[model samples]
Target: MEYPDSEAQLPLPTLESKPEAQITKLPTRPRTVFKNQLVDSTKSSGSAGLANKKCRARSLWYALYLPQLSNLDPSQQEKYLNQLAGLMQSVSSTVSFHPQALICEIRSSLKYFAGIDVIHQKLQLLLEEQLQQWGLLDGFLYAASPTVTGSLLLAKSGHNTLVYQKDNLRSALGGLCTDVLDLDKEQRRRLHNMGVRYLRDIWRLPSNGLCKRFGSNFVNQLNKALGKAPEPTCNYIAPPIFITSYELPYELENLDRLLPIADEILAQLCDFLRRRDLSTSHLHFSLLHEKRDHTEIHIGLRQASRSQQHLMLLLETHFNRLTIPAPVIAVRVEVKNFDAFFGHSNSLLETNSLDATHYKDSKLIQFIEELQARLGEDHVKYVSCAAQHCPEHANMQLDYRGSSKPRLKKSSAGSISRNPRPLWLLQDPVRLNINKGRLFHRRVISIISGPERIETHWWSGADVRRDYYVAKELKGSRLWIYREKGGERGWYLHGIFA
Candidate 1:
């Protein structure tokens, strides 16, 4: 120490040697990655660099504040928030819902949408469309900021401004009244008495004095608004199954009156599914009766879909067959079986090809669905080949509600038969009188084809053994006749072929 120069001999300042009353300066806002751009607070920049930095960070966030939403009751607010959340999910996957506002991180959506301006415009259009649809176009405020807290505060203060840089955040927050700060009544009174009417006045004070005079919470919130601290948020996740109900204004018995309500519900349900890129194969519609009883209708679709018009048409078909037992007070729609939507490309050539195929399939399915809806599901049936060789057991009838795929395999006995089978089969074979060793029905039948033998189900107790023949009636009508091989040797009529 004695050999050191006067400047070097001076004691180095230490944290403990500083006076307790000394005001420690607030830490500078740390460099952050915002909207794919790095912003460093410590770096001094010219006007152009600062302007460029501000532009780069502006796309980081979007805050949506619905002041009217805060006035709604908890349930209504929750429902509105859910609808808003669904709409916001179409804009960005990362959406956080506050009690009074919604914050979306749109940095990841820039590439897909082209740029921040385009995204902003698209979001504004979508939000406006939804608001107009819901009849809530007023008191909706929107802003952009690099930090969630900054954006939220700006939205809360009803400032539809975009804070694009850290420097911009200070000026933006500074313009707001001190009431925007999360301070107690006493603390606010003290601040007001001290002439700190604006956030800028508080910002000008030493951090240590402010903390000592007020509390740490005010300072912490201020830091969060300025992007100097982390702002934790809980993201909103959509429900897997979409179910909603509406109470009718009056008890209704007519199907025509219910159609409009059903249409609206289907529209909302389709919107929910489309936003999540989902389609439902099954939907349940329940009608709450005034007598506290409910009638539930289950709708099954041949193809999963998220189209509101298509769903409403299906519902109308079902409703046509429905007979109300009581006046309905409410209606609920529940969607349980949802699958990811497989959307087709909209190219002209591909759409033409797909449309042709889709039209055919849809037409067939629609016909079957209409038939089942009108006549009962059990009444509409499809015939499928059974795994049996006996003429009576060669095929079975299946419910038409199922997909048209082969359900039974052909038996080895049936598959090996070289003789052609009849298109129609009798429920039970009618005995043909054998007159002088020739088969006799209304007219004597002549054998056009010799016997093709079929024997099956020997392992089971019920066994069959027969020689089948394609016989021609005298009038040129073909008949499928078979004779029992072991018992009675009686000839029987089994089928006919035209």
Candidate 2:
């Protein structure tokens, strides 16, 4: 059909005007499989449909560059990097960091935030507040692209471009200056001598020529920027530990003066655990003094906890017992041993409730912890029965942090024995004088039950062979006496029955 001149001048219907259903109903095309696809794609002019499909399959990386970060000290740099990484988690789950830059994968977060634009707006607002708080008046630079290196290159080049599709990446990055490549002086001179001033000029050259001239490393970097090669990423993971330090305005020798500073650090640790739903059972405090000396204090809990009030109480107890050798110039707190926090059932029940067994256990743990803090941790001990026949090896002593219930192992002699044993054993057996074939201690002793022989550890160099008997003293007191079988062959008092 032929149209009039005026009608012919009218604009044609555009793809943007197509209905959603119509677009969905269109036939799908098979994906193209190219040999040396990474290289071939860079050389070919592909269709937009293929590009959109490729882009949808790849992750979108957003790079943030803070120029002021380089001027900050290493500690300050790490602090700001952590702060920015935490903020970026609101927009994306996958975040990676460089010296002064942060790269996050936004493709997965796009659906949650509705679109890339909304994500950008939310992040921009958050970043503005953070920058203001940090006193970074110079602000920052950012860019989004299909590849990590591409986004970083664009961000560092100050382009602030956002290219979502892999197909458009080449042209979008073509105009950037060669300096963004971070070339060495020699490399830059060579590029200049070769009249390669822009990235596009380098792209126009043959891959083999560039590899031979600039080395394969530079060529690989270019490929990574254009989405031709994959780049490895080190995603950020929040550490399980919390470490914070405070510098006092002046050295203070009084222990009471340090409580406030310690309280502040404890509060921060509690907040850190609360946000992560974690609890810690171990804490370390360092009191830095003059002359590069430090006093270290360690706190151990019977149960994992994150209560700031309880921590302060423990800290106060430690402070009461501590003797400051020198004035403290700073205080540093560290907590390692983190555990997943679960709401305690006992916490929801009354202390008197029959089901509040855990509450009673917690009370016991708290008491033990208090004692540990008051006395040194080494002074507090837990005694448990061991699995040995010898009295010396039958029981063991452990630190206060050991299990409340002893794990008993059955011995070859069985769980129960016919022989009656004394409740108390002496450190060293006392020799008894034999008077007319009778044993005598402070007073005369008579055998109540016959001898029970015990012989063990024959394989060891130090062997023990003895015959023990339950005896009674002249005053009606119970006595445990033993007679050596091989060596000494004399009667001795070993223990007393309670």
Candidate 3:
């Protein structure tokens, strides 16, 4: 490659002006693989030169590239990148996103997870697993280096490369084509016309000539990739709320087809919650139908949780009972409510503390959620003690959807007495025919205990004053009977004891 003459005063062409000068064609190359290297902590001569100056410490970064996703829409590509970012955040906090790649700095996380090699293996396994689940595992590449630019460049080369030493940076950059460089149409055409096909060709020319032709920005980018200059990268910030959608390749009408997709999304959702140390009480799923209609399914939990198994179980139960109105072309999952997770710890020895209660309560809540999901929420009901004096009105049925721990009314002066209540109570008292001062239905009934007086609810319109007793019938059945103190003055059957 010949360097342009400094004396030749020609105006550089702006990328916008020469639209047709873009490199529309390029040579195809096979995917390359580079061995992994442990980054050395010792400062190099190049780094030591700037050690006297205030330079940021070199951190190891890995770049992930998905070549197959290049043809996808920008928004779709970004969704995939965001999903990857959420997953990467689990292993490392510092993750940066690009148009076609993700850069993650895992230096600080190395020690906590053993070492870089183990982290690399774990990340690779996780990435492959997630990609397989998403059905996009082919043509995926990644590269690791101590510099962000280097890792990005190597990754863009469509290679699984890992470069640590400064000496190997040139080799990695040399293997890449000019298309990997951040250049527009005019600059790329000029480079190709000057016989600059590979990055190595750019290195052969004089820096001053290249600077004069392409301006200082091109040289700065090159220096950053070579680790001769500092490169600052913005870390990815996860959104406070999670709302992601997945478009199916074909409209799905069956539960089997839709459930796998939902499972994948829920897995990612669980990971997102786990990364933030949070839990969600409700998840709203909107199914986009083929006719442009929306069918919404909401899954609510009795308690906020991040457990994927529990969430999946509830979703499966709901889906089993659901009937899709139309074919769904897409699905969106959103978190309706989220809260910080203050996890519970179980005690080795049983006690009456909140933890023990919480353990039992969690299991009960899960059972209730499963039942409500399978049956309609309205079908399941909880019985709670109400603020009424009468035995028939003392307890009421509550909708299980919003039912928490039953807050039974404390023993108040007007509350029901400590006398034992029957397991079953009739909605209306049935009048009993008494003959010869003995109760009779089909046979003669004998009194098991003496009558207990009861009087209350005088302030309300309905005033009750009665004397109650427990009686035994011919078949060993027990009956609760009460006689009106004033009014019709008849005997009535109120309840039956088990």
Candidate 4:
């Protein structure tokens, strides 16, 4: 009675759940079929099963593409790419460049940078700052994938996707347009005729057919993008030569006035070396004079270094000994020799000891450089050992800047005798007077270590046959005395030991 009946009180059906008779079905058009049909991905013959496998260490690569670089000339493009490569070295040791892209292996760097996400954040910020400094308007696009070609293709297509896993690389690259591939006009036309608009469309075609029509190289390139084949790349190596010049507002003859300019140039060079992780042991400075030949100054370091303070100190030493020949209108600095920089790590336990050692070594080198600059390179010499058996020919003096390095020639026999040798050898061996079997340098001396027989130089006309002994004087001074075997058969004082 309450409602004419519970069934009669039911609500009317909505559009979602309408009665079959009330709903009308619309007629649909037939599906459009292109000339080529999409093949089954599972049956892909060329790179079959590659997308399902995991990427090896060498497979993970990151690519950055700068569209603005294409607008530059080839030389300018190379220079810019080199600069960018140096900057990228901070994140990855292996960096390579393409026509408009920079690619690096990131698998080894992921842990150091925390992860791919962190690396992306850091590189994005770094690149943005660099581009801004360069006055580039259009920003760069980047992609991380399992294959270099895959990452490059994704980046070039303006898709900033990151696919770190191999399993996701193919799918990530599938949607990219076919034009991203390096194709000739004829190849592009053929692809368009085949209705292959995207990479996935090409993948759909039979591999054998694609190989026969497009050639094996093209097919192999696609396979590389899918991690089926390895991609070989030449790493970008910055040129060893670093040259910078500064023009002075006015000509100056005094070296003191010219030093600030040199300092500025050296600062720039050190920054360049730091960015590239390089060091140079030799530097050339030119003092430019208007309408005259420039004065050249050369500075040499005992070891490779990039420290501005050290380099400037050497430069100052050279300037102290130098006299400006003419008024300098400009200054030029050049460095050609480069070496990899290896920074020393400090020890927590032996920090003081290491600091002392480093300080002592640095002071020694500084002293040598200053002496060489003041006394001339030839006058400042270092004694080095040689391979000759004769005592006179056993040691030679070498200049700091000499072309001849202290390298001993390979001896066919085993190493020379381990017997002690004196550091101070006389230019002429003084004939020692032997009285009652006692060797005398200035006073009577007693033999401490014996009579080691040395008979060598027989091959040469001047044969050496002597019995050498270490004798000590009354004052505790050690003398190296040798008794001749032939000729005069006399005793001679050859060397002295400190």
Candidate 5:
């Protein structure tokens, strides 16, 4: 409560008068550990495995950096934290302890466990398990996430498995002995000299000069018990990453025109990723397009890729409805989650696209993407099979653009036939009504081929059931035509030789 109550005082380990703290520890003696799904316990808690292996397991894991280590030397604690960090992915802040010690909290093991008790127990076991090698501080383990308040800890005594409820967390610690607060000997003497005692008393201080002068240790402690502040049992992770942004020159409604700008920033992101050797698995794209919709496009990558082109493709595809909400203003791309580029090690199969070699393809892609800029990406590409036995597969399409690129794909038949495809087929199949199969379209049927059956899709309503004839025309050329044999009666030029 670091406030002005006229009775302002700091609690110390050896109170000058052996006075109790005014603060109230949450009652823990009667607490029954119950699972609280709200808290993600498994990932940091290492107790689940122990429970699985042994019927009952109890271990105390205390998350302390070098300074927090009451027993170990400061240098030794730092050395151990560094060693432990190699094995554990931790998130913590290390500050020099007054006694010249350091502190770190490792919590990567909690996700796999079920409850906090199990996690706490497992962490305890881990600390004790490694005490012989690392020389820990009594192998005691405390549970809590970091809080905006302070780095103070909320600990559960013993090594037994026990679940933790969201509401019960306060009581479990409130009932704790005031000693867990661990006021310094000097601070204790100072407080005891004033005849003050108990966490409840010190916590009740008003917020004003006390907090302004003494700092946040008091408020932070209360926040820890109240849980408004997270006391995570984590180790030192990385510092929070920062992203840069620029103001848009103008509002951009077209996803296409924004490509260059996006490319520019994406290039920057690539550089950052390369430097960090990281790949963004998920990203958030903010588009302040126009007066219509200032949208945020959240994309989950099918595969984590740091490639500029791949990311562009995904973003371009997503702006399907990226109409300018307010005539387009600015755009920002932020990474929500990132992972180290796992397999970016040198590989021959990796696609290489330097500025010089890939310039043409990049330009081509850019040009093809222009339509997506002008008109929403509704009709970029269409997929239509050519001849039944063609090698080219689906023809170039502008309508089937939005079909998502699948992760796993199977082969499909060719759109055009491989039977000597023509160099220049008329857009509309030419009509040369044959007289009893007499050819005209530049060639005669010196040799006639079978009348293969062709059918149209029924659901689309443009049904076509025809018998196609491959005939060498009166001239020295070959042609293809389909004479509707079922519902319609007409000879239409389906295709012709080059």
Candidate 6:
């Protein structure tokens, strides 16, 4: 009848809606049964250690980016990585009412890895492998929990995970030490003296008395763990601005030589922060060299301060480790931090805006460009250091911002104390003649003096000297002259050979 009712058309599939962004941090209350359960579970299983790896859980973190880690300058690398760690640390401090300690949306990663857990596992593995190669084994971990919040909750709960899923969470937490409840040290001891050493003991206590004894925070954590109260989750503020770097002259393969260059560019960026009296929170590095392998490193500052020295130390440590290939072609560094100055005072150092004389980064940018021109980028350097004991090694050479560099030190050929330095030491020395205080450039020498002089490299067999007298010629020019054995004395241009 009437086409089986007008409303009876076939149903079409509609796509399900998904969250717009990944949940970056998760908050899980680690109280009662679930708390101790996580502890025993972790110690009983080997995977507990695996979970500690930073990349192991989803709700706690999102996409893990290992950029062209090899190409960045070390300073940037350290800052970047350390910042990541600090942010994760921040998650561990979430309030008890916070839900899901960490939540990294797997909507996209799920597409590539099969499932959210798989994606999380992959990232954790990546970090573990890389950190191992970098010789960093301590103070890092990643794990899974029944809820994204629980995993993060378990992290700061104590260095272990006794349980992971919602059902297992309670039993896993029963044995957890009371100290994991995010209480101050004094509060922890107070709980201890009150016979609430285990999370279960605290969980079983009367809520009204618990709150009265330890304040509302303790009761609040219990409520969140028991799913009675809502745990607020706050996303970390995404950086509004960031800066990065790259090195050219890709062929500069030596680590010793490259360290200075890396340091210099990073310093320039740090100096840029000084203009605004700003300090950065995070910095990262990528080292892209030859060979297929690349490396990325990072560092984070607890308090924002534009401290060049602090940042540099972290960078140098990582850089010093690299087993650089024969020749590296380039390096890159990125700074991922927002602008934060000490105060809003109007001093020149306190401003983040640019001025007429120079923009914040104008001078450094110009310097780098000009340096690339003359030194061909490859030969030019960004960093400098004092040379060593050898006169030839006195000062490390940096790219030109100033004066001409003297290529040579003192004579290695002679032991002469006063440095029988030529008026103009030449790559190719030209012998000269002198007679009675007049140079014989245009004529012959008229006088020879009693031999008195200095010589060098006697053991090494190089020898030369003379009772050099002021030389004269028909032209009347002064000359540096030395006598030879025979009667025939030859004269050649020396000082002004050019």
RMSD for all candidates, in order, please.
24.3, 19.5, 21.6, 23.9, 22.3, 16.8
Candidate 4 ranges with C-alpha deviation above 4 Å: 1-242, 271-279, 290-292, 336-389, 393-423, 430-453, 467-484, 487-493
Order of the predicted models by lDDT, top scorer first: 2, 4, 3, 1, 5, 6
Off by over 4 Å in 1: 1-239, 348-363, 379-388, 396-404, 407-416, 434-446, 474-476
Model 1: how far residue 113 lies from native, Å: 44
Q: In candidate 1, what are the lDDT values of residues 2-56, reduced to their tens digit?
A: 2111223234324233211111111222234344564432222234245654455
**lDDT for each residue of candidate 2 in 73-131, tens digit (9 for 90 to 100):** 98998888888887787777678987788999876666666677788888889888998
- The sequence of per-residue lDDT tens digits that candidate 3 reaches over residues 224-248 is 8898887767667665566666767
| Local lDDT at 449 for model 2 | 93
* Per-residue lDDT over 47-144 for candidate 6, one digit per residue giving the tens place of the 0 to 100 score: 54355433323222232333234356777565546544434332233212222223333322333444445554555655566556665442343344
> Candidate 5 local accuracy as lDDT?
0.49
- Best model per lDDT: 2
Q: Is candidate 3 or candidate 5 better by TM-score?
A: 3
Tell how far residue 48 is off in model 1, in angstroms.
53
The model with the greatest TM-score is 2
Count of clashing residue pairs in every prediction: 0, 0, 0, 0, 139, 92
Estimate the lDDT of model 3: 0.75
TM-score of 1: 0.48
Global fold similarity of model 3 (TM-score): 0.46
Per residue, candidate 5 scores C-alpha lDDT tens digits across 1-498 of 111122444443231222222321112221112111133334433554434333222122223323335566668665665545433332222222222212333222344444445644554555556655654444443344333112234433322222233344455444444554545676567556655564545545565744664458855666665557644432243332424344555555566877777777777777667867888766777776544555777766534668888777767776665554465565656674777675523347765665345555445545555455445456565444443332222343345332253222234343344444444445666566566666455545544775777565645576657777676666466666667776547766666565
| Global lDDT of each candidate | 0.74, 0.77, 0.75, 0.76, 0.49, 0.47
Error of 3 at 10 (Å): 42
| TM-score for each model | 0.48, 0.53, 0.46, 0.43, 0.33, 0.38
